[model samples]
Target chain A: AQTVTQSQPEMSVQEAETVTLSCTYDTSESDYYLFWYKQPPSRQMILVIRQEAYKQQNATENRFSVNFQKAAKSFSLKISDSQLGDAAMYFCAYQKGATSGTYKYIFGTGTRLKVLA
Target chain B: GAGVSQSPRYKVAKRGQDVALRCDPISGHVSLFWYQQALGQGPEFLTYFQNEAQLDKSGLPSDRFFAERPEGSVSTLKIQRTQQEDSAVYLCASSRRVDQPQHFGDGTRLSIL
Candidate 1:
C-alpha cells in the first residue's frame, strides 16, 4: 500500500517571503504521480501542482513548484512570494500509474499554512 | 457543470437517520471518486466509479455506506443508520480520464447530532 506523509502539521510564512512544505511517501510501484492540493476555508480543494514519477524535471506552476526527488521518495512544495491568500490546508497525494488499473488517491494528513503579514 | 458540484452544502442528521449526498461530476468526466474527510484531516478515499460502473469500493468503511453512479454523471453516497463517527465532510471529485488530474467539489459537510 502507498502512504503519503506530511511532516509539518502547521507552517507560517511572512507575506512576500518564501516557504517550503515537506512531503514523503512509500510506494512499491515505479510508476505513479504526486500532487499538492490546497483547501481554503470554503472547503474546495484546488490543485497546486503535480509531478510525474518518470519525469526527472520538477513541476512548476507559476509561484508554486515542487522539488521531486524520486530516489528519496520526497516531493516538497515551494511557494515563492507568498501572499495572504496562500493561507490554507495543504495536502499531498499519491496515485498509481495509468496502467495500474486503480484510481484512488492516498492523501497525507495535511499541513495548515498561515501567511503572516 | 464546469467542475464537480456537491449538493446540500451542509447536512445535519440525527443518529440512526439516513442521509444522502449528491455529486455532479464534470460534463464528460469518465472517472468519479468519493472521499470522507474528518475535521482537521485530509480526505480519505471511499469509493470510485468509472462511467456508470463502480469499479472500486474497497475504501468504504462499512456495509452501511453505499454509493452509485447510474448514468455515469450524477452520483450519490447514501449512509444508512448514520452514526456519530460518520460525521464529516464528504467530497466528490472527477477527472476526464483515469490518468487526468481530478477536480474536487466544495464538499458536503454532514453533521450527526
Candidate 2:
C-alpha cells in the first residue's frame, strides 16, 4: 500500500509572500504520478499541479510549482505571490497508472493554508 | 458537461436510512473515481471505474458501500443503513483517460443524524 504524508497541519503566509507545503510518500513502484490538490471553502477539489516520477524537471504552473524528489520520496508544493484566494486545504496525492495494475489516488491528511492580509 | 457534476449537494439522513449519491462525469471521459472527505481531513479514495467496468473498489470502507457505473458515464454510490460515521463529503472525479488528470465536482455533503 502507498501512503502520503503531509507533516504540516496548518500554515499561514502574508499576502504576496511565498509558502511551501511539504509532502512525502512511500511507494515501491517506479512508475507513478504525484499531484497537489486544493480544496477551498466551497468544498471543490481543484488540481494545483502534477509531477511525473520519470520526469526530472519539476512542474510549475504560474504561482504553483512542485519540488519532486523521487529518491527522497518528497513532493512539496510551492505557492508564490500568495493571495487570499490561495487559502485552502492542500493535499498531496500519489497514483499508479493502469499499467501498474489499477488506479487510485492515495492522498495525504492535508495542510490548511491561510493567506493573511 | 462542463465538468464533473454531483447531484444533491447536501443530504441529511437519519441513522439506519439509506442514501444514494450521483456523479456525472465529463462527456467522453473513460475514467471515474469516488472519494470520501471527512471534516478537517483530506479526501480518501473509495472506488474507481474504467468506463462501465469497476476496476478497483478496495478503498471502499465496508460491504455496506456500493458503487456502480453501468453506462460508462454516470455513476452512483449507495450506502446502506447509514451511520453517523458515514457523514462526510462524497466527491466524484473524472479523467479523459487512464493517465490524464482527474477533474472533480463540488461534492455531495452527507450528514447522518
Candidate 3:
C-alpha cells in the first residue's frame, strides 16, 4: 500500500514571502505520479502541480513548484511571492499507473497554510 | 461546461438513514473516482470506475459504503445506515486518461445528525 505523509499540520507566511510545505510518500511501485492539491474555504479540490516519476526535472506552475526527490520518496511544495489569497489547505497525493482501467490515489492528511497580511 | 459536477451540494441526514451522492464527470472522460474529505483533511480515495465497471474499491472504509458508475459516465456513492463519522465532504474527479491530471468537482457536503 502507498501512503503520503505531510508532517506539518499548520504553516504561516507573511505576504510577499515564500513558504514551503513538506511531503513524503511510500510506494513500492517504480512507475507512479505525485501531485499537490489545494483546497480553499470553498472546499473545492484544485490541482496545484504534478511530477512524473520518470521525469528528473521538478514541476512548476507559476509561483507553485515542487521539489521531488524520488529516492527519498519526498515531494514538497514551494510557494513563492505568497499572497493573502494563498491561504488554504494543501495535500500531497500519489497514484500508481492504471490497472484494469482504474487507479486509486493515496493522500496525506494535509497542511493548513495561512498567509498573513 | 467541461468540468466535473456533483449534485445536491449539501445534504443533511439523520443518523442511521441512507444517503446517496451523485457525480457527473467531464464529457469523454474515461475514468471517475470517489473520495471522502473530512473537514481540515485531504481527500481519501473510496473507489474508482472505468466507465461502468468498478475496478477498485479497496479504500472504502466499510462494506456499508458502496459506489457505482453505470454507463461509464455518471457515478453515485451510497452510504447505508449513515453514522456521524460519515459526515464529510464527498468529492468526485475525472481524468481523460489513466495517468492524466484529474479535474475535480466542488464536492457534496454530507452532514449526519
Candidate 4:
C-alpha cells in the first residue's frame, strides 16, 4: 500500500512571501501522480497542482508550484507571492497509474497553512 | 451545475440512527467518488463508481456503509447505525474519465450525537 507523509503539521507565511510544504511517499510503482489539494474553511477541496512521476519538469500553476523528486520520494508544494486566500489545510495525495486496477488516491495527514497580512 | 454538488451541507443524526447523503456529479462525468474526511485529517477514499458500475469499494470501513449510483449521475451514500466515530465530512467528486483530474464538492458535514 502506498502512503503519503506531510511532515509539517502547521505552517505560516507572510503576505507576498513564499512558503513550501513538505511531502514524501512510499510506493513501488515507478509511474504515478502526485497532487496538492487545498481545503478552505468553506470545506471545499480544490486541486492546487499535480505532477507526473515520469516528468522531470516541475508543475507550476500561477503562484502554485511543485518540486517533484521521484528518486527521493519527495513532492513539495511551493507558493510564491502568497496571499491571504492561500490560507487553508493543504494535503498531499498520491494515485497510481491507469494500469492499476483500483486507482485509489491516498492522502497524508495534511498541513494547516496560515497566511498573515 | 458547473461543479459537483452535495446535498444537506450539514447533517446531524443520533447514535444508532441511519443517515443518507446525496451527491450530484457534473453532467457527462464518467467517474464518481466518495471520501470521508475526519477533522484535521486528509480525505480518505471510501468508494468509487464508473458510470453506473461500482468498480471499487474496498476502502469502505464496514458493511454498514452503502453507496449506489443507479442512473450513473446521482449517487447516495447511506450509513446504518451511525456512531460517533462516523462523524466527519463526506466529500463527493467527479471526473471526466477514470484517469482525469477530479473536481470535489463542498462536502457534507455529518455529525453523530
Question: In terms of DockQ, which candidate is strongest?
Answer: 1
lDDT of 4 by residue, B73-112 (tens): 9999999999999999999999998777789999999999
lDDT per residue, candidate 4, A1-117, as tens digits?
Answer: 898999999999999999999999999998798999999999988999989888999999999999988889999999999999999999999989878877778999999999999
Model 2: per-residue lDDT, tens digit, A34-72? 999998999888999989899999999999999998899
Between prediction 3 and prediction 4, which has the larger DockQ? 4
Runs of candidate 1 exceeding 4 Å displacement: none
Give the candidates in order of DockQ, highest first.
1, 4, 2, 3
Question: What TM-score would candidate 4 get against the native?
Answer: 0.98
What digit string (tens of lDDT, one per residue) describes model 1 on residues B1-113?
A: 77899999999999999999999999999999999999988899999999999999998999999999998989999999999999999999999999999999999999999
Docking category of candidate 4: high
lDDT of 3 by residue, A72-103 (tens): 99999999999998999998989886542447
Worst ten in a row by lDDT for model 4 chain B = B94-103
Q: Considering DockQ, which of the candidate structures 1 and 2 is the better prediction for this target?
A: 1
Candidate 1, residue B51: Cα displacement in angstroms equals: 0.3
Candidate 2 runs further than 4 Å off: none
Model 2, B59-96: lDDT tens per residue?
89999999999999999999999999999999999999
The 0-to-1 C-alpha lDDT of every candidate, in the order given, reads 0.96, 0.94, 0.90, 0.94
Write candidate 3's Cα lDDT for B1-113 as tens digits: 56899988999999999999999999999988999988777888888887788888987999999998878888999999999999999999999887898889999999999
* Each candidate structure's count of clashing pairs: 0, 0, 2, 0
